[model samples]
Target: MKASDQTLPLQNGETLDILFRSHPRARRLKLRYDSVRRAAVVTLPPGVSEKSGLDFARRNSDWLQEQQKAFAGQEFLSPDNFISFLGHDHLILHQPDDAGRVRREDGRIIVGGPAGGFEVRLLNWLKKQARIRLEQAVEEKTGLLGVTCHKIRIGDPGSRWGSCSSRKTLSFSWRLIMTPATVFDYVVAHEVAHLREMNHSPAFWREVDRLVDHATISRRWLRQHGPQLMALQICGKSPAD
Candidate 1:
């Protein structure tokens, strides 16, 4: 079946994939499911046909569903929500000041009112710190796992805690900062194992297990409270911040 022959109509709970062709700038594809819009988005590289794109989605159906479930449980942060940083609970504050800082003075991340808003700016700062901390942790743990990574970056990713690309770049969600240190370490180890083995094979599990003695607890924490962390608004930043 060729891509030009037919266009597939997406049904409820059914997945539809698309491929868009354009300029030769880069080989890239982006995935997002618009629940309100009621469709899955697949932005492909230039010169790609719709059929090949659909086939790609078919090939990755299981992965796509896993991503969708991850998205479903995510909670976007609101202003009234309280966020715990370091040790104390700070009500998300929205203020106007020359500087945006997420700091502890008298044991609270004072927001707005000369401090700053509690959303985008604060999230950006947290992402910056989380990347530094996570990359350090990844380097230390991967040494034990006996693997090297090309690069590491932290992002406001919606689907998963972390992902390892074929090129060896390790991308992690900045939301990991909300969790305890142990949980963060486990995620770092999990991604590093991908360097040794791309698939979730037994060898991969063994590598992760070797680095983090208690992996299941961290995994469970994300399964249960991960969405809650997603819902937190710090420094008036968006969830992706």
Candidate 2:
């Protein structure tokens, strides 16, 4: 049965979730086995019956088994895992000594100057600096584009370096702080372009080009180097961890 046709209590080992959209269309049944959570979620249309969803999962049992196998041997680090930032590889020093400097050496953030709590202190300072630089880039380019943005926020995002929401808010990944100045400008320009053109249309590209001529180069840099920034293995994991 289609996921949209049932409404009943879920059985053991099954969790229910429904994603509703204003643009109603064909109902889909997604049985995702989350290895990290160690459970299976049967996502169906709202007001759907649990018996049919369970049956659907049973029918796809082989596929789910394959997925679990794929998740095997995946490495998940704890908060204390060592990470390499910029180009420097270092341990996550939680015990602050208060005798270190936040330096940009080669490509890593060096936090061991005179400070004892180097990791926490360095992360805090870097986040602040990143916010400042991102806000400046956004302001400078948004003016050029003649578009007013809602608000600028900085956080660690797993997937994208930056995102433009329908609410007109622009959020940037904190990892951008590790990249060169050019990549930072490109991301800001890209998000600002969304203000004028909400969608990724030709007009949006035109606006981005006007602000940053080498937008494509910066984009390529993200696709290549962005993942490395995320690899800089400091502890304190995000939700995805």
Candidate 3:
């Protein structure tokens, strides 16, 4: 299920939903935040009932609330906060005196600019990276499929990541840049495949598989984490702020 589908109410009327699933090897009920997926997860042991797991969740509401708060505005790019780049977290460092352009070094995004406009600089840098990679992937995948993509446009759309127009123009979310290259490639391949077959028919899927191996893995990754990327505010002020 998508992250937006279900929500659990926490303190301050916040709803950062927790994911509950059963695990055969679990020895007991377990509740912890999945940093990679950015959600609270509860695991029920073989004999533990779902009711017990939920009660365990509610019993620890205080900790859960803290997690929710930490994750809420954590996506805002600022000094001392890490931002996603190439599917990895890069610490944001503002070197105001340097007066250099944005660059990467030692698992950090080094920004040499005034602190107030620091995030805006990083935002533009990330978008440029998105365009370069998306275009390259589209060109390669379309060539393999023996099709043509008229144009490629990159932007940040809240829900949809990528789309194919009837005119053969392809649009993709700049947020895809935050994910691993494999995930980015999967989205491009999916859209380029649409150039050959508009509908998501079996033939269309077959075309996608031909362009990208292990398509299922990439699809699952997106469904699990895409919403988080959508919720992540790159530039604008957070709703809570």
Better of 1 and 3 by lDDT: 3
Model 1 compared with the native: what TM-score?
A: 0.63
User: Per-residue CA lDDT of candidate 2, range 113-151, in tens?
Assistant: 543344455667667778888888888888887778889
Residue 119 in model 3: lDDT: 67
- The lDDT of each candidate is 0.64, 0.61, 0.76
Model 3: clashing residue pairs? Answer: none
TM-score of every candidate relative to the true structure: 0.63, 0.58, 0.68
lDDT for 87 (candidate 1): 26
| lDDT agreement of model 3 with the native | 0.76
Candidate 2: stretches off by over 4 Å? 1-108, 112-117, 236-241
